[model samples]
Target chain A: MSIPINSSKAIFPGLITREREPVNLEFAFPTLDGRITPAEQFYVRSHFPIPEIKAEEWRLSIEGEVEHPFILTFEELKQMPARTVMATLECAGNGRSKLVPKAKGLLWEQGAVGNAEWTGVPLHLLLEKAGLKAGVIEIILEGQDEGTISEEPKAPGTIVFAHSLPLDKALQEQVLIAFEMNGEPLTAIHGYPVRAIIPGWYGMASVKWLIKITATATRFHSYWQTLEYAYWKDLYGKPTLVPVTEMQVKAEIARPALQEVVAAGSIYRVTGAAWSGEQVVEQVEISTDDGQSWQPATLLEEPVRYAWQLWEFAWNVPPTPGAYQLRARATDAAGHSQPDTHEDMRRTYMVNFVAPVEVIVK
Target chain B: MSIPINSSKAIFPGLITREREPVNLEFAFPTLDGRITPAEQFYVRSHFPIPEIKAEEWRLSIEGEVEHPFILTFEELKQMPARTVMATLECAGNGRSKLVPKAKGLLWEQGAVGNAEWTGVPLHLLLEKAGLKAGVIEIILEGQDEGTISEEPKAPGTIVFAHSLPLDKALQEQVLIAFEMNGEPLTAIHGYPVRAIIPGWYGMASVKWLIKITATATRFHSYWQTLEYAYWKDLYGKPTLVPVTEMQVKAEIARPALQEVVAAGSIYRVTGAAWSGEQVVEQVEISTDDGQSWQPATLLEEPVRYAWQLWEFAWNVPPTPGAYQLRARATDAAGHSQPDTHEDMRRTYMVNFVAPVEVIVK
Candidate 1:
């Protein structure tokens, strides 16, 4: 039976949306305040309607390349010691709206990302209990939410939203089967009862409403892993497909919002947040005069692994009143930084260019 | 009738407090995430219980040194063009807890500061409508909430929370008569119908539940301004008293909270926020190994006029496991930076000293 999609909740009061059916928080809301996006205001990106599963009846199955395939009930899973981590989840197509010739998916602005404290048992511990085989090459996680992928006729008619990680990534100590978000039980929209928290990866890699985990001896290819969520690049005049996995470094202005007006000769505080998927953000710089000169913004708080860092800069408005452009760029510990312009890719999966916010000084 | 102080509503879920009879939002909640503190989460520093004023009956009186002394109804006030500003507010006794002798009143932590988007008519526009007199010396703002101060038996039995700003500051366009906060009408606890937003002054200067604005021919010296908020200091062995007004530069770490344990050899982001009352923060440096060496932190956004700017630094945990001391200091536009230790002042009003956050690595 198909789960009914409900969009009547007012959890997020002023959430902007590109698509209403699956629900998406506008790019401006999360950055408006605080660091951890409250669970109620956490962004929801679902391909299909949410599935309702009774906690008592819910069971997670571990099959395939395991020496002992087993099923664990929700209560049984909770009996283990839980680890908590603050991780940021961003849609693969977060900045697609900024791309020219607009990308064909959910045209998200920057609001497609949020950081939350997740609590759960480590996936590696569960994997160890399952007794993984030496030849295992990949681990596939499947969510209960299922729907027909009409866009891909060649794929199975109906399949669960699923993705796979290489054996090394799947066994990382940071990966977890999360049951709580921001100190509260996960809401239905955020995968109640159980979900997978794959730190440092795009939102797609962390399957919600998780139902099954399968260890395989060979690389697993699903519609999401092979057909969608991958960027096609022209390398030496040849098409090469690369899967969108970890998030690239990006920054966004939260206050003095786009097109905001300020009094001339007044000092205004400009602020925003920045994040990198797999590595810590090393630096974030703000350019008030359209990149002609750059000044460093003070980073707020200690960076947590898999969490975005908040940043700020002080801009002295010129005595003369007119339009001014503001831009922010972030660099990660991996030595990757945002480029000034968008890359020419076949798909707009990760648009990490330095987008300018225009402000008028009156 | 005395205004009733209601605590039935939980606007701030985790508000730390020194007194419950008169509400006060502790200093740590506002820096949790984002830039603007949400209306519900905005810190409250109230002396008397919130006065319940019917919106229809509420009137703001503009009297004293003006050609035309007039009263404005709520509707009339809303008819004027509204100006929105993201300003930071902090209690004058914010760092009183750090005082050695234990300063009188609330022992607030760093959470007393918050940035909010306030919307209302500019004070200058309203003053223009009132037609200011040629020699107006001060603008006195009076809130409706009133209570007897046991500490000042020589003063009036009942006194309203009142303060005055200089003529130049009162006429500044940044000063606002705010009625809306964070896109919603103000709550009763936050001065519902009207409150003054003095961009760069201490929270006392921005009187809440404001009902009167008086332009005085002579300097207005209220108990709040002259006796309570003033800091007694020793200048050349002579006792001198100075009014607490603008905020001094301060920095506080917001994440990996104090005494948090971190994994060794892991990359962690160390971040915090910094602010100066009237000037912009010019620099913020972080020292992981005490004050021996310092590295510049990346500021996240442009420095706001009266709001704190978030900052970050990537801290690479040393491979060996042990305790680490992290310290952050800020410098403002005037070249006035935070001191290594607290100033030797008789009163603990403004404490702008570098604070170290201790953490253990395992």
Candidate 2:
């Protein structure tokens, strides 16, 4: 069967569209309810126009900084031992619109994240067969998607989408080279043949439409790595530009969407998802009294690393008829709580702060 | 006789009240006109309750790192060569409400800025009389007002509000130890006894209720200096925390308030003010076509050094009825233009970006 190019449109009815050409979509956070986001309703983030790589024609190449290099066909890659995992993929710029002095990227509003279950061959198994060489610092995963940077900090010409993972992260048994999502073969728009699911990191680490993998002896820095996905960190007491690795501690209220109206004196179930990468979100607190105090929300399930915990807060509305603001704050197991302020510096990535929703009660 | 403490309340009639105890006030931007903001309508920002330092009882101490230390009472400070200059005092955190996630500080709109004719003693003459010692790095300016920081990144008990300026900035002839605002003596709420007017810096640099002036041989690091007013800057390729020095190039549209409605086919005279600290705002541009295209606005007066330039744009609205966003951007002589987007980091202060005002046409 022939693959469809740029077919992500119209299929997902509920996603908020930011860009049409590159197919950037945010999930309808107010509509979807459940721990696992349905495949049809999952968000889509594309660096370039969706490349049509047929399943039969695709081959995964493993080379560079390895003792033995090999290429595996789609069927051969699928023949290897497989594993299934549930992980959340959050774009680094998910809650960017919430930042004051809104940054110059897609005006995303806390919906650019979704959880999914996938079946794939463990990447470490493939890496074991390839036999990583000594002194290897990174494994660069490349995607078939190629495009030129059109915005500020513009790059020269068309370049392929690529990202590198450290040896330890690549060797993690749960990291997958997946071909199926939610019990079905991957849809063309969702990286059909194979995609690397890099758990515990921002979605950018998971290179989609996997085509080639190169184990590098030195740190691999690409346009997306150093320029786009990088953020300022205080490394050694300096505002050092470092590549974004882990997802920040964040909680987003999905139910009772922004600027909604509700009845006074009614129990509004404030529901949302709290997530962190590598770290566990220990508590999700809801603030209905305009942040003077907070009430702990009930987590629907036990904390899972690299996955979002579904949380609900039963907020009994006061009988007073007035406007109300609902704010959710998530604190990770590492004691990192969400601060509702922005640093003076304004880059366009990694916005994990708490954003509030305003509702009028009548 | 006793001096009244924290008496900056209920004096200013039209000021938008954010906090009552500390008396944080924003000017009614849409209501005021003219270059010099009226004495009764000026904006006020206080770290603590307005200290009522009576002119008779107030003492200005000019001590530390100096060949000759001296003290001056309010009358003595006013006797030392007074100069009147028109300058704009803008809170560094102006327009913070426009930030997406809504920061933790008082949600200041564009009204947290005002231009006034400040008459005061040139600080350089005072420093000249004190005879600066060699190796003096910074001049610390202290206010009589003291309070504990009740917010996040909270500090210890009842600290005095103070800030230090680099030696070069302190030596500028226009930096004031003034006892007068406009043609009248300083108002009770606007630093009753004496205040500093740091031209080309945010209002925080202009200490109110001035009580002490200290010269330090090394970097004078204080709570407000390093913690509150500091921002992360890429120093020597590092995101080093640096004190926020100059006001960023910013323009605020006052004529067309946010979310206003107007006639479709009428001429709308969009007016605003543009000011930059130390930097000369060369041009002010307005975008009526949703930021896709920008048109230059007419600067009403010559560009003042440290004062805002009033500007107007005559827009011939289209006959068709629809919604439109109006954005104003300023470019300084240094070629630094206002960026529409924010960087990723979120700190509490210094937001000088272009914010749009939405309007509907019928």
The lDDT leader among the candidates is: 2
What DockQ does candidate 1 score?
0.00
Lowest lDDT 10-residue stretch of candidate 1 chain B: B1-10
lDDT of each: 0.78, 0.79
Tens-digit lDDT string for candidate 2 (B96-156): 8878766657889888899988889888898999999989878889888887765433343
C-alpha RMSD over true interface residues, each candidate: 36.3, 13.3
lDDT of 2 by residue, A149-247 (tens): 755334435677888898999999889999989889988778987999998898998889998988877656565655567665431122334567888
Candidate 2 CAPRI classification by DockQ = incorrect
Off by over 4 Å in 2: A1-362, B1-13
Question: Evaluated with TM-score, which candidate comes out highest?
Answer: 2
C-alpha TM-score for every candidate: 0.48, 0.50
Per-candidate total of colliding backbone pairs: 46, 20
Chain B TM-score for the candidates in order: 0.92, 0.94
